[model samples]
Target: MSSQCPDADNANATPATEQWTSISKHVVNSYLEANNALLAAMGFSSTAEDAPTTESAVDTTTPSPTAEIAFGDENWVMERSTDDYDTLGVGDYVRFSKPIADTDVSAFARVSGDTNRLHLESDFAEDTQFGGQIAHGTLVAGTISAALARLPGVTVYLSQDLEFTGPVRIGETVTAECEIVEELGGDRYRLHTTVIGGDDETVIDGEAVVIINELPGK
Candidate 1:
């Protein structure tokens, strides 16, 4: 259940315990304040409050330590390609996957109050050429990142060249995969990507420039 008291304000200097009924519900900064005040009230008798902490506890770590993508080594960019040499070429693979669904889409519709038939009404899809409801194109593009995450050394994507070649029907599982097609100078690798449906037909096709960093800082 939500707290009965008014939401905390920036200007208010009230003690968090007095304003917020439960300690667990307090915001991070307010929780810290309440904790410190509670400790101060205890006269610092608790060893837990006085113990020294290690730097590693608060330090952030990379998502994948082993994943490495080779960016341009110095020579590739120096020699400006005048013809087909710019292509990323065959045998280069870019991987990607389906996006997980959640109740957020329902909440999003409720909050924004956008009751667009395509987004809210599955029945409306029956009348359309697509035959059934489909997610927004932008939403599908976000899933492309998840797919590329599976491949090694691909840290960041430069752009999404997404084309809705065919409708992505509801309940269908689609996967995005790519192949290296061209190379743009300065650590940018151009990948030709496609979103394939359960039937193995292309649903979306596009190109992306990915930055492959060599030797990411550990």
Candidate 2:
């Protein structure tokens, strides 16, 4: 879209539209330059796409050498990615599944100060439509982070946008799936994150922006 300059209020006033225009232009130009360079260094011919793309053509990811996240401890036994950050591209992802145990929900409520009766008091919830204690939405959303953390390199979360589709009850299992949807230049990547469970339904859906960086030495 072509942006028009807003009428200036004072000699020093800059137009809001113009500011946004310049910011957008700079971001695009910088991304194109950086992404192209990265691909060239990696010996790839394809460049970043306008929309999120799949990683089907590129099978760079592999299985984990060992399941560091053993079962029976946290009950987090599910998909784990063995892909390196340098090799990761669009559509790459890591998934982790963990049961929303009653204790987990209660702990989250206590620590996060979100002790809503709906999630803590079973009797209260039983009387309500839920019919039992439900887990906090944010607590379920945290699973997305847990999955993303399993990705290679040091994962630093830049932003996460989420939408809760359904509620999770104690003892129910939830799986967080995060896939790269866009290469946002440099070490930054945008992922399509979703948490689903209970009769194979989507409980929470969202997008996450993360920066995967190399360790101090390796």
Candidate 3:
């Protein structure tokens, strides 16, 4: 019976490992160069590392940090819209559209203290009726708040009713729109509140009563 020398085995393995490491680095560099060229050809002005974040890419006219967060994506027209309920007619409405990033759900969980396994864990969610992780019904409902912020006046939510009709996957852009369905008289109004899923389907629909207080000194 015989046994190989440990030092001899290590010596043989070193060159193979080093050779593969060198090859891997070359392949990576080639990929990076190719990617940069394609990005340049497609009008990508900055490399991914140098690209501006959604938060920084926006113009400086935003009114608040929250508004800046809501307007994270400029591709959506609603991101640039102003809050003005005075000009709203019965059929008119405003929408706030933004994609639900992975960070959003995690942040919601941390802030809300709603660490529902269905909303955070994939393995557990796969067994649920939802079949996979779906955004919290309440978190998705936050879109309603984003929309109402766009309305004129000091908007206050007196009450709201939500009927969750579908699940929204993270990263899917959802648009929350509020329409003046009926004027409740005085400074109050009845609104048709809804959230349109990224798939262009209605995932949430309900009604809300709000007080649109007039601006101060005006």
lDDT of each: 0.51, 0.72, 0.69
Lowest summed lDDT over 10 consecutive residues: which window, candidate 2? Answer: 1-10
Give the best candidate by lDDT.
2
What's the CA RMSD for each of the models?
A: 15.0, 20.7, 15.2
TM-score of each: 0.51, 0.65, 0.63
Q: Tens-digit lDDT track for model 2 on 142-196? A: 9898988778878999999998888788899888999988999888999999999
Model 3 misplaced regions, further than 4 Å: 1-86
Clashes of each: 8, 0, 3
The TM-score leader among the candidates is: 2
> Candidate 3, overall lDDT?
0.69
- Superposed Cα deviation of residue 56, candidate 2 (Å): 61
Predicted structure 1: lDDT: 0.51
Error at 95, model 3, angstroms? 0.9
What's model 1's lDDT at 50?
47
